[model samples]
Each structure stands twice: as structure tokens, then as C-alpha cells.
Target chain A: MPLSIVYYAKEFFRGEWARKFLAAKTAPLVTPTYFRNYPELTGKTCTHHLFCMMACPAPGAIDVVRTPEGWMPRIHVGHCIRCGLCVEACPNGVLRSGRILESMFYDNTKLSFSFRIDVDTERCMGCGNCAVACPVNKLIDSQMSHGGRASTDDLLLKVNEGKCQVLHVEKCTGCKTCEHHCPNEAIHVARLLEAVHAPEDEL
Target chain B: MTVLQSLKNFVRSKSIHVAYVDVGSCNGCDIEVLACLAPRYDIEQYGIFVHNNPREADVLLVIGAYTPGWEGKLEGLWEKIPDPKVAIAIGNCPISGCLFNRPHTLVDPPVAKHIPIAAQVPGCPPRPTEILSAILSVAPTVFKDYEVRK
Candidate 1:
């Protein structure tokens, strides 16, 4: 059938039903007898926000729904507000906050900065302090920085070992304490055992 | 009076015609207003329909904040619209004088300052649902059961 024909037929029937339904349902929602005296308010307050979400079928997109049991509120990670309030409110330590920033150039160049806890392959004794301290699941060992493909010997950390003042093994725990606190911003603590990686080339 | 009742009367009588004008907006609000014509937001579900000529239109849906140069044009357009007609200021820029509100900027701060606005819809490119609510609020015949979403 032609699009306009389909539209007119569907719209005509829908309009009749909607008008009848609205006349009944909208009466209590608006002031009675007031419209007879003032018609402008009819134009001024006509709105449809309350019923719009009922049409959305996307799961986890909306936090609240008007179900047969009445309005129901659901919490899902995909629906996160990014406010960090839920993370702080969780009693079982199930939520953890993570941040990622990416800068893209029209020429297809990419620059990104991400912060995550990982082992310092050269010095790590695998004590797993950071993993245990994490609020989320203790999958700290799985939190590889580059990717878990490279071994400790294959990974590289650009460090001036000769200029480094702290040389003693007893003083260095290899737990990334110095890398975390380094003011010069030159030290890059790496997990050599993990995979060495680079950003994928863009098309 | 309840806007809903007046709206139903208007729809039953088939009385109002609306005109849309684009000023200095980023076109986001314009798109939302357009969505009202679609199946979901369906503004035409009521008797309201868009008019090409300002003189015939019962309501002027002004989208975007007016620019300084466009002030005279807007005034002229308002004069062209027939009396008893409502002027609706849609979007945050025209209502609250948002990002386009810089004093030295070329655009006028807000449409309300330049014209006798009948209603204002405030939003940073408000959702179409909100736009529909605002439209129906000003011209009840624009929609039947108007629900303003946050």
C-alpha cells in the first residue's frame, strides 16, 4: 500500500482511540472547569513526558518503568550515571570507578590516557597488595596494562638505571611505589611478563 | 483552566495553525521540533499543523535564539502573524539566554526580551518530548494529554 494511505488509515484510527483515551485519562490530571474559563492554559500545559518512556524498548537504558505492579526502578551497569554515587553506596564493594580519555585527530592519529593498577614486572614479587585493596573483584593479576602477551623479559621500561639514585634491591620493592610517586614524570614502570602492545591502526 | 480541555476543544474545532522559524540555533532544537511530526512524537495527532505563511498561522514556533541582525526580521514576522496568536520561545537560548547570551555577541540574548513571548521551553536543545509538552502547553490543541518530561 502507498505510505500516505497507510499513514492516514493508521493515524485516523489511532487518533480516534487516543483522543477518547486521553479525554478520560487526562481529566483528573488537569484542573476541572478551569479550561472553560481559560483556554490558553490548555495550550500552555499540554505535555507528554510521563508516557514517552513506555515506548522505549531498550533494556537498561531507562532506570525506572511503569509496570503493572506499579513503577519499578532497576539498577544496571549499562545505565550508570557516571556520578560515582552508586560506587560509594554499594555495600558489598562490587563497583569500581574507571576513567578513560581519548584524543583523536582528523589525520587518523590517536592519543589516549588510561590509569589502571598493574604489576611492575622487573621488581614485582607478586604480593598482590593492590589487587586485595581494590573494591571490585580481586582480578588484579588480570589487570594487565599493555596486554597479557609479553613476558617480564620482553617488556621494556624506559628508565635511566645509571642516573637512578635508589639501586639497592632491599630499598626497591618493585611494587611501583617510586613510579607512582615520581615527580619528574620520567619513570615508566612496566610488567615485562605482560604483552608489549601498540594501538591498532585506523582505517 | 486545564490546558488539556482547551486543547481538546481546539482539536475538536480544528482551529489553530502553527508556523516555525529558525533563527541562530545550532539546529538541535529544530530537529526536535521536526521529530514532533514523526510517528512517535506526532504533533499532528491533534489538529495542529504547520503553516507556510505567517499571516495565517495561529502560533509561531520560534526555534533558536534571535541574532542581533535577525531582530528586525523577527519583529516583522511577529507583526505579520494574526492577532490572538501566541509566540512560543523554544529552547534554552531563547528562554534563559544560554550559550548564545554573551553580551557583545552578535545574536540577541533571548527572544522573550525582543518579543511578547506567550510561552518558553527551557532546555539545552530540549528533548522532543519536552518540546511537545511546551508546544501543547502554549496551544493546548497541539497535543491532547501533555506530559512534561524532565
Candidate 2:
């Protein structure tokens, strides 16, 4: 017992174990390079083959929606698991994520995505399809007094001043419910991919 | 409130004990809950502890659709948690059954039909941060009024 104790003590104090212990304590910890990140748009044209949607394991995580630019895959962040399967499944290089797809992108702490609503003033007939179909707007203005009309200004978007105005862009969750409800396809919700921390003033 | 009572309120509001249940989900929401427990989110930093027993839970996180197997079992589980308990629906499944409560699926439409839900974190399976914020926002108000209840 004494011999074993001496050997263990020496190993703990001066052997490889001590070096390992110190290294472990001082090593800079970082997320694995291969760790899956949220899939992002690559600006490549989407064939809309629905491979990404089929491969996504999380429910309501990915969907192919029609935009004026054609069919594009929309990632619902709330439901996304970041499995990277959708990234692997895309036939075209449209959706990108994971170390396999890593390129000379911004090396930053956060890579977030935000959706911005773009109203085609020329195409928008002020029909209020998007305004009426927005779930948050409905919740905020439940008493939508008139048919397809905002009863109050406390809404995410409204058909005010004879045009659909986005009152609060921050309220957009990228669910794209409004995009689907648009009959003339006037309202466009596009995912704004941010690879690095934007300036506070710009935000 | 007395000093002791106020102190209790402070502690109770800051801390929460959550019990998780998976009625019949595809395990997607449960995985997200697991992510909340992991160090990246570290819900313990906010004084949130997760366990399996509803008896010790201040908040009940309901996942998945109300499956047929949990028809009466879910209610029994809810009754196990003491009063001043807040039930949080942690996914779109529990809120509206997402893709489960189809035309004639063997699941209930919404969990609220069986239990009183205090909050609904609506996502197919919500992000861990979203779940954390939901719990942090709801647990305090629900437990603050505990000691004062007649």
C-alpha cells in the first residue's frame, strides 16, 4: 500500500498526469470546429426540390416557400435543431452551414439571422392580406374593427396611409405567415444573414 | 410582507424547480429541454433545477401532443404538483398539437383542455434560450403569490 501511494503521489506531482492536469486547467476552450451551426442561405438559386425540408428532423424546422425569386428554403429558428442534415441534403449549394461548408466567412462569436419585410410598392395594391393574416398583429389588434383593417396602430404592420407600413419590424419572427397570405405577393420576407456583430447604432 | 415572508418571496421568485413530461412527442422538444440543462444555456445559473418528480416541481413543462396514453395520466401528473404550480407548454405540440393532432390522430388538440397552462412557448420545438426566458419570466410571478394564498 505504501509503495502504491508513493508511485501515485509521484505521478500526480511530477509525471505526465501533472502536465495534463495543468494543461486542462489552462487550455482555451472553444466550440468544436465541426460543431453544427444554423443553416444559412448561400445566395445560390434553390431548385426547390424539397430535399432540405425532407431531411430536417425537427418539426416545422424547414419549409420551401415560393418567393418572387422562386422557391426558397425558410429556416424556422425556434424549431431548428441545427443538425446540419439539411445542409448536407441540399443538392445545390443554396443552404450552407457546418465545417464541411465553412469558407472564408466572418470569424465571430455569434452568427444570427434576421428577417426583413420588403414591400413592393409597385406590386402592393394596399390589399391588406399580409396585415390581416399576421398572427401577432391579430393578437395585438384582436378587435380588427373592419374587414382586413387594423383597428389600432399598435400592430406589427398595418395598411395605414393607403399603404402597408411595417410599424414594428422587430416583431417579425420570420414565420413568413404574411408572405403566404399575400394574394398579389406584394409583401416579401427575406432572411437577412448576419455573420458578425453589427454596429449598435445600425441595430 | 414580513422580513421572512419577503425573503421567501425573493428566493422563490429567483429559483424554480421544473419537472418535464413527454406525453407522446417525437422527442424533439425533450431534446431542446435537455439543451436548456446543458452548460451552453446552464439554466442552473438562473436557479432552475430540473427533475422528474412533479411533487417537487414549481413549474410543469409539458411537451408533445396530449397523446391518448396520457389522457387521464396527464391530469394525474398535474395534480401531483402542489398548488402555486405553473404549467408551461413548451412546444407547438402541447399548445396546438402541431403536426400530431391531425384530423383523427390519437392525441388531444391542446393540453390546456386538461390542465391550466400559465404560459405557452410556441415553437415546433423552441430554442433553449427561448425556453429559458419563458421559464424565467413565468416562474417568478407564479411563485411570488404562493405564501400569501389562503
Candidate 3:
């Protein structure tokens, strides 16, 4: 049987567990994770130029996964050699090495943390520079009402009135595209680390 | 508290000997770490000493991100440290690879990936004051945990 058929049969018979189990066996020697100390922001500022994805030496190390909100970049730790190329390739400084784990159990959701996107309402002209730069145009356009005519030259972005609002918080991937493209520095994206439940006695 | 327990605490608290290592860094953090022991910072007044040998060290201060070539050396040094040791990553490089998180020279994961990290002080090159305070804050918790395990 072809590999595609084999994969399909496995998925149909065993469901997601077969793949998850396979992922666990090949876990990285050392896990290098990233986190944003700040919490109020959303979505990475990634412009979707995919620079980091290209620079990554490992195949399938960096990929875009579809969330309910939209497509977001995902890091597969099992294949990662702990090379920092993807981090350096990012111009927005969105990715930073955070925790180093001696071992890691397979968890797809735990591979990358989520981000929150916050707009600086005061500084934002609602020019849609972020919208233009965003890889998922439909997600941005669907959320915000277009007030002004779209500009051909992104150099001078103008919004007649009202500002872009992130309708969905969990949808953000923290790619840092909007944060980098904003002329007035209006957008900020931050990662949200899972809160550790400290023991009551420790607290 | 039992007399033996109190005595152990007293002796442990009286002095904190540190071993400093730089894996792959600009040595900016190394200078700042050393400055803490200099007369200007005078950490010795608080019974802190930079012993430079891991066998005598109660605390291991790692100053750089672990490079590909130095993994064995780092592991060897880590093993040489006596038990009840506290490892504090001194700067951003050792904890997060800092600005050198690139692939050209094989600067991959931070030090924590190799050894267990007790605490971390973050900054490209953290201030001497920050390094001093991180050491002070992390030492007690590590010692306490060690005592509990014992």
C-alpha cells in the first residue's frame, strides 16, 4: 500500500493516537521552548513572509496549523535540533528561547504557546496596514468594519474613523506581522504561558 | 528545630562558594559576574566567594548558552559539583540564547536544556546588582529544597 493510504488507514482505524504515539517516541533530546513575559497582547507580529519557516534547517520543524481563528505557526519539537535559526530569522523579535526541559512528553497543543493581540487605539489610524500585511486577510477583514477606501500605497495608511478591533483573542498566532508592519507602532502581540497552579502552602 | 538541623543551616548560610562557567558568550556577562566579587561590589562581605572550581562550589553560575562543542565539558563540570548544588543561569544568553540564537555557529538550546536550572537572571548582560540579587534570592530556596530532599 502507498504511504498515503497507510496513513489514511491508520487515521481511520486508530484515530489521532497512532500519530501522537509516534510523535512521542521521537521526542527531542532537549526541548527549547519560548515564552513572552508580557500577557496583554495577541497574535505574533509575523507578516507571513515565512522567513523563519524558510531559514529553519529541519524539515517540517515550523508549520502553519489551522485553528478555529485561522492559520498559526506550530513548532514540532521532536524534529528540532535546538538550532536557533528560526528565532534569528524573525525580524520582529517575537520568538525568544524560554524554558529548557531535560525531557518532553508528546503534546501537540503544548508545543507552542498562544498569543493575545492588543491594538493601541490612541495611536491606530485604522489604516488597515495590519490587514494588508496579515496572511489571513479574511480573518482581519471579517472582524473589523472597513471605514475608508483601501490605499494602494501602504506607505500612507489612513482610517477615516473607528479602529481595528481583534474580535477573537484565541485566534492569534503571535506571528508578529502586524506588530512589525504598523507605521504608528499601534499593535502589540504577546504570548500567554500556561499559569502554574502553585500549591496553597507555597502561596 | 533540632540542634543538628540548625547547625547545618548555620554553616550552609555562612558561606556560598560559586563556580562560574562561560560556554559560548561575548564574556560581557562574565565581566559582570566577576564584578560582583570585586572590591567595588564586595559580595565577600556577605560571605559569597568566587572559588572557580566546581568541586568547592555550592552554587554554579552559568554565563552563556551551551554551544554544540561544549556539551561534554559542561556535563563534566556539572557532575564535578558537590551535592546540594544550586545552579543559577546568570544572563539571557545562558537562559535564552540572547541575540545569538542563530545557527551559523551552532548556538542551539540554552543551558537549562542540559542541566537542571534552579533560577535564571534575564538580560543581555544583566547588571552586577541584578546578578548579586539573583544569587542571593536563589541560594536560599535551593538550600531549602536540598534539606527537604535529605
Candidate 4:
């Protein structure tokens, strides 16, 4: 069977053993590479400090704090699955795994960036999943009504004639929940300034 | 024989080395394996070492299944590992072609067809402890003399 070809390769060539030897030789190299690339001890300071603040549920209270250093992550320690969703989400290599754990355990105070989502008033559906998922309620109600309790009519959604021909006068919070959650990348948060400026410039 | 003696005996032998290959996997399993190395699971205390090179590995622990772009590379790497080597298919993709499995799929070939698998560890990605157990069971002789000195 063609499937047996793999077994044939393993048995006849002893390829598995060779790979092990090669790995043994290379294991030492990986360490040096990691250190040279990351350089934990040098203590080179980060110029830009962004905090990805998270709110943790206390015994009875919710405690919110900004992460002092590194890439601002959406999740916290007990809550992190190490799935790397936040890591991948980071455009900068601010949020990293592996040895970063060692540094975090040693020094709890490090400067970092906090990612804050600003929604365009014209394009948000006001679904509060992002607010709910936010570990530190950073994405809270910018408006008076809380928990996506804004007037639907007040929220304006814009349609790009070239991009999305279909128009809907839907209620939007400009909270960016729809833009962030839209799997198809079809929805975009419309900037309030851009919409207001367009008609004024035309006049 | 008592479990302690059996454990003792298992540590005395020098067994096989395992190497892992990531072929377009989402890397969920990779993170779990790394976690196993941490203080929590501590698979290293049992004598299993994860290797990078394919030539010296006694066992090939493959994490992902075939994608069209990566098929040839996987085959090439599989050929490089020396034998008497056992292939341990880990994760649902290699065994049953889990999420990425489709008839007209880009990288559709099941891992079993690509190599001669000696054992299978099933899970979306099996827990590291489970992976360690699978490795030990397949190559008991190599691990007979294993001792992890803290």
C-alpha cells in the first residue's frame, strides 16, 4: 500500500534516529538565539508604554488595572488559554509568550501599551460582546446610557456607495463591536468627523 | 512487580528520541507542549526530550496533517529521520483529518498515508501528559535508564 511507503522510509533509512541526533546538536543553538533576540537581562527600556488594562472579578468587587509594561493583552493570567489570540492580534511584538513569562513573574511592574477601541459613531451595532469580553471594562459606554443602552436612532450607520451599495438606517453606537466582530470584514466603523466634513466641504 | 520498581526500571534504559514537526498547524498543540515543559506538567522529569532535528529522532511526533503547500516538505522531513523510528500521530487532523479535512481540500492527505505511524494520540490536540505517555509506551527500551535530576 502507498501508505506503507512511510513505514518503508522509516525502517529502511532509519530517518527518525538521524533527526534526533540533529535535534540534539541544535537544541543548544535555540537558547542562544532566544536570548540574543529577546535579551532579558540588558534591561533596555521601552520608550512607548501602552497598557492593555484588564478588570478582574474580586471576591465581590471587580478590580481593574492597567498592565504596566509589554504589549497590552486583552486577557489576563488565570483567564488566558495561551491560545495566542491576543498575541496574534497584536500588530507589534509587544505581547509575546515563552520567556516573557519568566520576566513577568520576576518583575510585575513593566511599562506597556493599552489597546483602546474607538468606535466611529456611524457604524456600531452596539453589541456589547467586546465590552463583556474586555477583562478591564476599558471599552465602556462613552455615552450616558451604559451597557449599549444608547438610542438606536441616534447611532448613524454610513454606507459606502462603492463598497456596500445596500443601505440600512440601522441604530449604531459607534462602539466598534460590529466592525471588530464581523467575520466577513464587510462592516467598517464610520468616522463622525468624515461624514460631517463631507457635506460642508461640498458647500 | 510494584509500580515504583517498574518506574525505576524504566529510568535505567536509554530509549528513543522524539522530534516534532509543525505543518500548517494553528499552533495550539505547540503551546500545550510548551506548557508541559513548564513547572505544572513537567514532562522532562520523566526523561522525554523534545528535539528539533529529524535525523536523530527515534520517534516522529507530527502535529498537523497535510496541506497542499506543505505536503512535500513533510514528506522530505519524514524521509530524513532515521529509522527503527516510530511515527506517533498526534491530534485529530493526522488521525481523522479534523477541521481541515475535506475531499477537495488543499492539504487533504491524512498523516497515516504520509508515513508509517506506530501509534496515535487522539485529541483536538492531546494533552501533554497524554503525549508523554504515548511516547513512553512506544519506546520503552530507550527510556528504561531515564532519570531527570532536579
Candidate 5:
């Protein structure tokens, strides 16, 4: 054959061809990047000091944008390191650090989805208000727990007996009834402003 | 069907420059709006560009509930924006002030009472797609309105 053809064949075998041939033998699992979820909850009496923006370490992760009301913190998901600093800085427990499956993140543009509630375990006084107020709580079968022994209703009423624990986060609709009804303000519901999805085009 | 109409449609569909203005809104709608500029939503795919200056904007996106002091400033900004422009009120703040519409000293009236809203996207924080669609739907009407006036 020709010398150029031989050379080109050699280069392909050494570079992309070798990788593709090897890939046929063993496929590697590509780990999706995990995003630290921050619920963008807005409330009636929020002080709006924007200390969360101040606490962020990553540049452009949390930007302070001035609206007509006042300055508010806006998170840039692309730049966010998911360090959870902004969540810690929020005095009102407005921000909560959670993990979201980047691939499982849905588009809220078509159908609106609220953020799941994150309970500050330390702050929770085992108040059963969240359990009682939860709309999904009624759906949770009481017999599902403890070898089909204890009912959810019994557990909810006695929720304050020990410590309030968030049993099922996925079941939460982000209705924020628990957050609203909580006297101690232990529960913080996530407010989703942007749709969570892998970027279509990476800039 | 006609040459002039086709020419106008081509220009209208070619590019849309949007300027986002927040009066008294929680940063929720702003975040959603900014997401459209990000790689995920990427409104640029539709030839829509989020511009900073009102002078170059084809569409003015006014987000937030109106407050007392900002009336003069907002009106001034509105005046600065050139004609044949569409104004979209994104999120509940501009429409009804959402939760902030409480009878209080700081809260003002809605944006509709001040500047004429060509379109309204109502949500506590409207989805980026909703905002995008609202802009698309209203842009043609705004252009047609301008053409009629001329």
C-alpha cells in the first residue's frame, strides 16, 4: 500500500482507534457531577441582608443583584463549588445544603416543581406540626414501618417525643406547610428558581 | 404573502435583544431569567440575546413588584427604551406583588398600573421557558402595534 496510508493507519491505531478498541473490551462508568442543592425559599418577613452572598467562597457562585425591593443573593449553578457556605450564612435557615442527582433534575419550565424541605436537626424540637401539616403524611401508610406495626399517624403525633426526623424527602411536594406551621422555625423548604439539568452547551 | 410583510417577518424573527429590569422583586425571577442566558436554557438558541442596555433592547423584561420610590426611576427607564418594544412582566411580583403585596409601608402597587405591560408571566418565580414563550408571543404583537401606529 501507500506510505501515507500506512502512516495514517499507524497514527489512528496509536490514538483514537486504540481508545475505541479498548472501550469495546471495557466500558467505563461516567460519574455524573453532583450539585449541592440550595432551596431559594422566599418568605414574608425575610430580612434580605444577603449574608449568604457574602459568605460564598467561589467567584460568581453567589451574586448580589439589586431589585426594586433590595439587594438579594442569586446563585450561579455553573460556578457553584457546592461548598455549602451560603447555606450556613443564612441566619433564618432559609438556605439548606442537599445533594441532587444532576441527571435526575427535571425541567420546571413546563410544570412547576417546588424544593424539598430540609430540617435543621439541631433546631428541631421534635415538633409534630410538620408531620400533621404535611399533605403527603396522610398518604404514608402507618403500617409501613417496624414490620408493619407502628402507624404514621401515631409516629407523627409522638414526633415531638424525641427528635423530629425527616423520614422521606422524596415524598415531599415542597408545599412548605411544615415550614409555615413550625413555631420554632426548624424546617426550611427549598424554592426552585431555575430548572436543574445538565447544560446542553458548555461555554 | 407580500414582499414587505415577508421582509418584516424576517427581521422580527431574526434577533431579539432583551433587557431585564427588576423593580421590587425577590431575586427568584431574576435567577430564572439569568438561567435562560446560561448553557442549560440558552435562549440564544432562538436568536434571543439578553442585553444589558435598554437603548439596544427590543424587549424590556420588567420583573418584580413595584415599590413607591421606584415609580419615577422605572418610568424614566421605560422612556429610555426605544419604540417597537415589548414589555413583559415576569413573576408574581409585577402582576400582583405575590406575597409582598401585604398592606405595608414599603410595598407599592403592581407594574401594570405604571408602564403598559405587553405580556405577563405570572408565577412566584416563573420558569425560564414560560418567560421565553411570553417574550416570543408578545414580540410580534408589539411589532404589529408599532406598524399600526405608524
Candidate 6:
């Protein structure tokens, strides 16, 4: 054991490993460029097209606010899903992140599905059963916890003035719970599957 | 203030022990954390070590939405960690409950109500780099001035 220790000490003192050791210690692994980094503003100015805001799936993720230098899109880091949809939605070269835009042009296809709730007012009796069954409604509005008759303005949908009103359609998870609970069949939740593609696709 | 004490403190700060807890998360954040430990992210390069035990940990990683199943017991879990410890809430679940915050669900979000959070990394499940940065920036502050306090 002592002889082995002496041999290792001699090799260490010879200093072949010192340079490699220093280099390894000084440098660390970097996040890959293809990684979906947060969106950053480029030299191209924002035109307030509001396309980025529409494309963002996460609520409050992207907002076109009037900054001191005019209208610009502000990305809320805490809420952003980093899905890169906002980067693709910008008409001008205002925002860029990773290779999300390049992926759209290549054979890589992006698929997005959205839910649209169509309520037929003619057949509606305003029972609020769908609202009571809605998972989002019961979670957001504590008043709905007991029954759906509560008048809170935060619910996804509620009975107001003898008719069912959809408050926040964006909050729907497309669970179809509301559609299943509606006895009158007035509320119909339709799933819209759309393919994401480049705006100016030649082929 | 002695030389030996300062050296010990420096050595201790250089080596950080991290223990993670999942109160009620969907394991998305846990997957990201696993990536952090992977060779590409390599959190250990910063001298951060991860294990499941909380007693020896200097940093506690809390991931997940506050679920009903963990109710009345999360506070007890918080007490297990030794002092000079920092809790980093990873992903949006713990930050705001994210998608799990919705109806018919048993999630009680904003995990800060139960445990004190030193930092937060927000996303559906944040990138591994974000988790690495969160631990690197926050852990040292709690261990700062170790000998002086003693």
C-alpha cells in the first residue's frame, strides 16, 4: 500500500494531469444551443400584430404592453411554458428563441389542438349543471364548491340572467365535463386540431 | 473567525448536499431534475450533490403542486431539514399550481404557505438549466457567514 501511494505521488508530482485537471475545473458544460431558451427581442421592432399573444397557450405568458419605447411584447417568465409558439407567432423578427422557427420550415410538423365551446342559447334553460360539473369552475370559484348558483365572475361559465354565460373560454381544459353534464345539450365543446406551419410556405 | 473555522466553512460551502421532495407533483419536474443530474446538465460540477435523505442536506428541492394527499403532513416534512438550509420550489406547480390548480382537483397551490421558499423556477416543468441555475445561485447564500454565526 505504501509503495503504491509513493508511485501515485511520483506520478502526481510529474505534473501531467495538472493542465487537464485545471482545464476541466475551469470549464463546465454549457446548455445546448438547440435548447428552448427564453425568447429575447432582436433589432427588428414589434408592430403590435398581437399574433404572439394569440399563439401563446399558457395564460398570461405573452403580452403586448406599451413600453416607453412604444408597443413591445413582454414575456412573463413565471407563466411561460417555453413552447416557442410566441416566437413563431411574431410577424416581424421581433422575437427569437432556439430553433423553433427553423423547425416549422423543415419537414418537422407542429400540431396544436384547441377547444371551442358553442352554447345554443335557444335550447338553454340556464340550469348551471354544466358549470357545476366543470372542473375549472369548481377549482377557481370557491362559491361553486357548494352549488353552481353562485354569482362569482371568475368561473368558466355560470347562469346569468336566465341564460348560461361563458365567462372565460380560454380556461377550458377540453375535459368535456361540461358537455356531459348539460341535459339540454345546449353546450357543445368542439375540438379543433390545427397544424402549425410557416406563414409563407411555397411547398 | 479562526483560520481553521473559515477553512472548514469554505470546504463545507463548496460541497452542498441536496435532498428533493415531491409533495404532489405529476413527476414532470422530477424528470427535469433527473436531467439536471445527467452528464449534459451536470449539477455536480458546481459541487452540488443530490440524495433522498433530508437530515444531511443543505438545500431542499420542493417540486409539485400542493396536493390534498400531502395535507397536514407537509409541515412535519419541512421540520426534518437542518438549519442553514434553503428550499427551492421547482416548476410552476409549486409556484402557482399551474395546470393542476384547476377544478374538482384537490390541489392547494402556492406552496409558500407551508414552507418558506428561497427561490422559484417557473415553467410547466422548467428546463434542467433553470434548475441548475436556481440551485447554484441560492444555495450559497444560506451557508454564507457560517463561522461568524457560530
lDDT of each: 0.49, 0.76, 0.64, 0.49, 0.64, 0.79
What TM-score should be assigned to candidate 2?
A: 0.47
Please provide, for model 6 over A1-203, each residue's C-alpha lDDT reduced to its tens digit, 9 standing for 90 to 100.
Answer: 99999998887776667656533253555678988777888857888756677677766678989988988888887677788877775667588899876776585454454678999999888888898889888788756742356757878888888788888888876778889998899999886556655333444
Instruction: Give the DockQ of candidate 2.
Output: 0.05
Better of 5 and 6 by DockQ: 6
* Model 3 accuracy (lDDT, Cα): 0.64
- N/CA/C clash count, model 3: 15
Model 6 lDDT per residue over B1-150, tens place: 576766776778778899998988889999999998888777777788997788888888889988888887777777888887889999988887876666687888889998899999998788787888888888668767765645
Cα misplacement distance, residue B111 of candidate 4 (Å): 0.5
Q: Could you tell me the lDDT of residue B84 within candidate 3? A: 78
> What TM-score does model 6 score on chain A?
0.49
DockQ, candidate no. 3: 0.01
lDDT of 2: 0.76
Tens-digit lDDT track for model 1 on B1-150? Answer: 566665555554354678888878888778878887777656665556876589888788887767766868988998998665778877766764555555576776567777788877655455566666666667653333333232
Q: What would the TM-scores of all predictions be?
A: 0.41, 0.47, 0.45, 0.37, 0.43, 0.68
Candidate 4 C-alpha error for residue A115, in Å: 40
DockQ of each: 0.05, 0.05, 0.01, 0.06, 0.01, 0.31
| Per-residue alpha-carbon lDDT of candidate 4 for residues A72-134, written as tens digits (9 for 90 to 100) | 223322122233322222223345545543443355323322222334434434444333322
Q: Name the best candidate (by DockQ).
A: 6
lDDT of 1 by residue, A45-128 (tens): 212222212222222323444556544433332222233332222222222333211111223332222223333355543333
C-alpha RMSD (angstroms) for model 6: 9.9
lDDT digits (tens) for residues B34-84 of candidate 4: 776776665555556667688888778887766767767888888898645
Query: After superposing candidate 2, which stretches have Cα over 4 Å from the reference?
Result: A1-38, A47-49, A54-61, A68-70, A77-83, A103-203, B2-6, B26-46, B90-104, B109-113, B116-134, B144-150
Worst 10-residue lDDT window for candidate 4 chain B reads: B141-150
Candidate scoring better on TM-score of 2 and 5? 2
Interface RMSD (one decimal) of model 2: 7.3
